[model samples]
Target: MLVSLARVASESGWVRPIVDGSDVLEIAGGRHPVVEKALAASGEGPFVPNDLSLDGQRRLLILTGPNMAGKSTAMRQAALITVLAQAGSFVPAARARIGVVDRLFTRVGAADDLARGQSTFMVEMAECARILNQATPRSLLVLDEVGRGTSTFDGLALAWAIAEQIHDVVTARTLFATHYHELCDLAAEKPRALNLTMSVSEVDGRVVFLRKIVPGAASRSYGIQVARLAGLPDAVLRRAREILANLEAQEPADHRHKQLPLFEAHKSAVEEALGQLDLSRMTPLEALNWLADQQKKLR
Candidate 1:
């Protein structure tokens, strides 16, 4: 095993990580090994490398970005490098010096246990509960889109509270990726929390993913633009843009008191119309028809 690791490291230009007993993590130009290898094999340019710095003082990172911006990739690479160092294998990093992590916890993606009658949100909360109860100062955590399966306000509240708990109590090194851009307010409230974002750029009026993690909160989720890129019907994209603008106009000044779900409390005619939609099974043509019906109702 040792011989094979050495050979791979030599071939891949990997570096030796310093795994001394410190309570800090400092990684320079860290790359995801599997991704780098795949990129090389596929001739898909080069995998972008990123740096990470975490310690007792600044252990929580709030990562916000649009979809497919490489937030999960960055989080996975950091965890893999630390684990590889502990396993006595060279890591894919220019330099690495991290303490021994007692445990590694991750809560990313979505899943459900319908056979057992557990909803997606229930499963998400259960895994999050495990992290909250078990993780410690020496633990490493990677979380993504916490509280996303629920309503907007509910999700924001839960995500905010969980981030606070992790920073104040667990004190673990955490990389949290979320769509609730409101959570970025932690930089002012929590001294130990830092905001980071996956960088993207606009080229020729098109969004180009830079695949680099930079310090600061993202201004927007860019969900509409991303959806358009995914080839959603033109009619659907137009309706989405309209709804987004309406919601933005109604959003509260304080992010914590976010607007309630569109169909709750004060219902806009459009939202009330959309609320009746069974989007899960709706065909594009049906969706277009629904939108036409809603527009006629408004008129």
Candidate 2:
């Protein structure tokens, strides 16, 4: 098992990882052993390696990028490297170090349990609940494409709350691969969180995957472009691009913009007032006051 990891960093590098004392998990130039061999056998281009750095403080990594951009691969490699490092084996990295992990938990793609009468989203939530309940600070979690099987707002809200719980309460080391670009705001709100994205390029109106993971958030998902690559009809692709432009104009790119808690009191008061209001019974003063409160909350 420890003999794994190559293309990016071979096991022959022999950088034995320290797992007992340090409050960190760092893997430089890590790659999937299976993927490396598969790519080599297929005579494909070189495998792209990525680096990971996590510690007790900065433990949550919010990974965002387009579809088929290697986000899942990067998360899986990080987990594999951690497992090997803790097993007292020379890791497949230029260098590797980690605090001993008590348990490793992962929730990948959505799945359905027919025998259990659980839908895909239900099964996903069940697994997530278990991980959240059992994982500790010393544990490592790899979550991929969470909140993807449900409606946009529901999934986004669930993902947002789940991320907050892990960052504040669970405090587990995590590599979360998601398509939610707004989650990059986590890096702003939480001191222990950071953002990562897969690199890509736009050349001659086509998208190319660089397969490299780097710091920072991606601006958008290239689903339309990918569908074109997948051989969707040219007319369909053109219409889809038009619809995408319309949708983008419908809402701000950063839909869930981050704002400070400076208006907490005003916000609470406004919400409470709105919840109790009877529009038909409102006086002139009441209308004026409500408008003023709404303006204050906005600011």
lDDT of 2: 0.82
Model 1: per-residue lDDT, tens digit, 108-146?
A: 889999998889999999999999999999999999899
lDDT of each: 0.88, 0.82
Best-performing candidate as measured by lDDT: 1
Q: Return the TM-score for each candidate structure.
A: 0.82, 0.80
Poorest lDDT segment (10 consecutive residues) of candidate 2 = 256-265
Clashes of each: 0, 0
lDDT of 2 by residue, 98-175 (tens): 888899999997679989899999999998999899999989999997898898777877888789899999999999
- As a TM-score, model 2 comes out at 0.80
**Candidate 1 displacement at residue 167 in angstroms:** 0.6
Task: Compute the lDDT of residue 203 as modeled in candidate 2.
Answer: 92
